[model samples]
Target: MPAERLDKILAHHGFGTRKDVKRLCHKGLVFLNGKIATDPAVKVDIGSDTLVIDGKKITLQHDLYIMLNKCRDVVCANRDGEHQTVFDLLDESLKHKFLGGDLHCMGRLDIDTEGLLILTTDGKLTHSLLSPKTHVPKTYGVGLRDALSEEEKLRYAETFSKGFWIDREQNEDGFNCAPAVLKWREKDGKFTLEGENPALYEAVEKNSSGKSDCLLTIFEGKFHQVKRMFAQMGNQVVYLKRVKMGELSLDPQLEPGSYRELSEAEIALLKQRQTD
Candidate 1:
């Protein structure tokens, strides 16, 4: 990418328009590479140069690939009339300033669901990731209302590995979903082993009133698939959060409702296909 003006970078980060940037510059409020800034028109290296305003880091990237930590109550659509959308987590700066147009959400998550969501301007990448033929894996952290017995967990894992029948009432595709993977999790969605893991059903049985948690990975995109899959097993998902998509994992440092630009290495991981 080519070099960009300092004020433009600030404006692209939602610091304000060029005029506002000039004001900040004149007040000695802008700092470039730890030095006080006096000029707003100075050119900057988008990747190497760091810009700080009021002690906040300003990121300026020409190729935008955002990893948003979505929170509950937000829809995944580009626009929504009933509730907030994922893009709403971004500032007005990214829309028209940095990015030329609206950012597209690669995969859609339910309104009540939260966690990792990829937003990019690359159409081809989006097509490749979302296409059903690609069979890209998406992993979710799940919380169930009832504690699943050891047998039930085994059955669930087996059912996921082999294509299973969706309750006909929920889906009429006439074909079963592709094989998926399921694993146990602690209450906070951290991974644990099957036998050595105390968070498994065996531990839940001791309390008798605790909810069970697990991690689920699927290759297909179906409406209410994860929630409904468990429902068929006489279990209910009280909470759902997507933790991984394709080869990208949500950054733990990013808090809910916050987002960060994907590093170049992370971007490459998304395009790397798995081989058997």
Candidate 2:
């Protein structure tokens, strides 16, 4: 990377304005490679040189990626007057670090929906993931108001695979969804698949009297698409939560409204899966 003015770099990192960084330099709070740096205009290599401000080292990176286990009722925006946003869950230090950069969510989840939400400062990666042509798969765990009959399950699966128009009255105005995969969950919280273990049946007999649970994987995102699909079939979606995106799954240990930086391996795998 090219060298930049010390004050410019500090301001870019949200230490403060150029004037504020100059003030900090003059006050002997800024150090460059172990020496006091009083000249704000002095150029420094951000990637190679060490910068310390007020006894704390500043580690600069080209991009930042964060994984947040979102909770219900939180909007996926940077700012909202009426409701709390996902950005509010991040630590204040991180918010200050990327103050001037283009930090945003990869995609949005409804205010009532919960689960995996990704926030990043990498605009290129964000665009690649959100592009309609990418067709990345997103998986959601859904809770229905009532259980589906065996015939209804088979019928709904086929209907979803064939794609349907969301708006029946105004076909031109409505959007058509892409083919999606729908799998019903058995009573033991396992998907009903062929050649399952006999133990699964024992558990099903022990606990099989509740609302239906299923997993839906869709390649395209539409406004309330999952809920609408269920509603069209005369069923109601009581709860919704995203569980996976591409090859990245939400960390099971992460609590609601909590977040952590993505590991280097996870970030690489996410990008790799996009191409695959």
Candidate 3:
């Protein structure tokens, strides 16, 4: 979004190599502001400059952001033993690029959990997203092991929106948490898991696994926070999947183990969430 070398901008936009851009510049094929650019090294304001190559405009893309639809049996850590990690779900090319850049996750889901995850080399963005001050809400699609009565569901909903206190392991005393947004959906389906819990995965659909599903958006990320909340409600979480984080949702097209690059607009949305 700042001023940069014309050729570098063009190359970054995937127009061509720097050498190719130089050739085009010299051949009067590249135009900027109705004038032919003779030097590829010319400085241009990418945010305002109108760049045309072979009679077409180009927009330059910056940075690399990834959206991963995480699945079970994979850890969120950089490296773990005897279990797959989120990085393993990436394409080899992405893995290499990310590792070389020292990319990291903004937040982590448990190895048995699945859903939306943002992986990036942008440290500032990652930190901002993870910061408590930002209060970026993360939404999860949860599967419960118990059914609740209408009266109980109302109590749970009221508790979720009004906030509550929960017990902690580190201290006998507990902490008060901010209210979260929740959407409930009753289900009679079986869960599908990889290696973490096979029995839950093997159960037949609509065969009374006795589970309820809900979508929850929490503003905080404590260790096993969602599980604790459900436990406090006298319910057990049998399966968990993250569906959204900030303004980014899990790409519906992506399979459990697949991932894809985020668009420039998507990146903007995420940054907006931090400041909003």
Candidate 4:
């Protein structure tokens, strides 16, 4: 709620750049509480006042938190070259809701994977969740090799048993990440996948047919970690889905490629969780 220069405040609200803001002010296109304000450097309280630029009312929008049930084939980026980015799924009306900068995905999922993806305008929140120092947990559901072996499961669980740290590649800023936690679960004769010590003959037939009967996974956010882990175990990942991150889960009611704003309580809890 602190006072900020009129031009900077307008730009932050997605009006335009500083130059554009100055032009708006000088041209008498900017108004404060209904009166034309021509001074670009004039200080105004950003959190408590309404602004009008060229007759369009711009209210100070609170930090936005949105969850999108990302669908397959959509890239997890703000801009894309060959595929549709997640932002494409948002309608124009909702797109304008973003006052300034584009929304950022907290963590990424491959174009082939589908599940909960969190988007927010708050940079600090995104950094908190993705930062290795925070140790935020993420859970993924995976479809393992049809004829997965017990030995394969143990290998994934104990790959780093020797306590070695492998650094991942760096980003443009030279920030790198170390390995993350990995674990797995075998669905013992579940409804979706069946195998009750079914005769060896039955197991062989199912294996040859390329049908999986168990799920394998862990709560880790390493780059291509799930797929690579399975590959290391000599099994190819047939399907992958992120189920949870931090304290948020995909709402059962949300459909693929759709999004809704987060509730006030949800936002507060998210910040609180980070501090805790």
Best by lDDT: 2
Q: How do all models score by TM-score?
A: 0.68, 0.83, 0.68, 0.67
Candidate 2 local lDDT, residue 128: 84
State the displacement of the C-alpha of residue 79, model 4, in Å, after optimal TM-score superposition: 3.1
| Candidate 2 clashing pairs, residues 3+ apart or interchain | none
Q: Which ten contiguous residues of candidate 4 have the minimum total lDDT?
A: 199-208
lDDT of each: 0.76, 0.79, 0.73, 0.64
Q: Candidate 4 residues 1-276, lDDT tens each?
A: 457688776776767688998888889988898899989998777678778889988766646688887878999887889999998998765564344345778788999887778888777788777776676666555666555467865665566332233334344221122344444433544323233223222322221232333333233456776666555456677766665566565665666788898887767756764742
How many steric overlaps does candidate 4 have? 0
Q: What is the lDDT of residue 26 in candidate 4?
A: 86
lDDT of 2 by residue, 1-276 (tens): 667788877887887799999999999999999999999999888679999999999886656889888888899998999999998888876775442256789999999888788898877787788888888888777789877788988999999999987764333345787889998876566676455344333322222233237778899877778888888778989887787788787776677888899998889867974632
- Model 1 stretches with alpha carbons more than 4 Å out: 1-62, 97-101, 169-174, 186-190, 193-212, 274-276
Strongest candidate by TM-score = 2
Provide the global lDDT of candidate 4 against the true structure.
Answer: 0.64
Candidate 4 TM-score versus the reference = 0.67
As a whole number from 0 to 100, the lDDT of residue 180 in candidate 4 is: 45
lDDT per residue as tens, model 3, 195-243:
3223222221122233336667799988888988888888889988776
Show pairs that collide, candidate 1. none
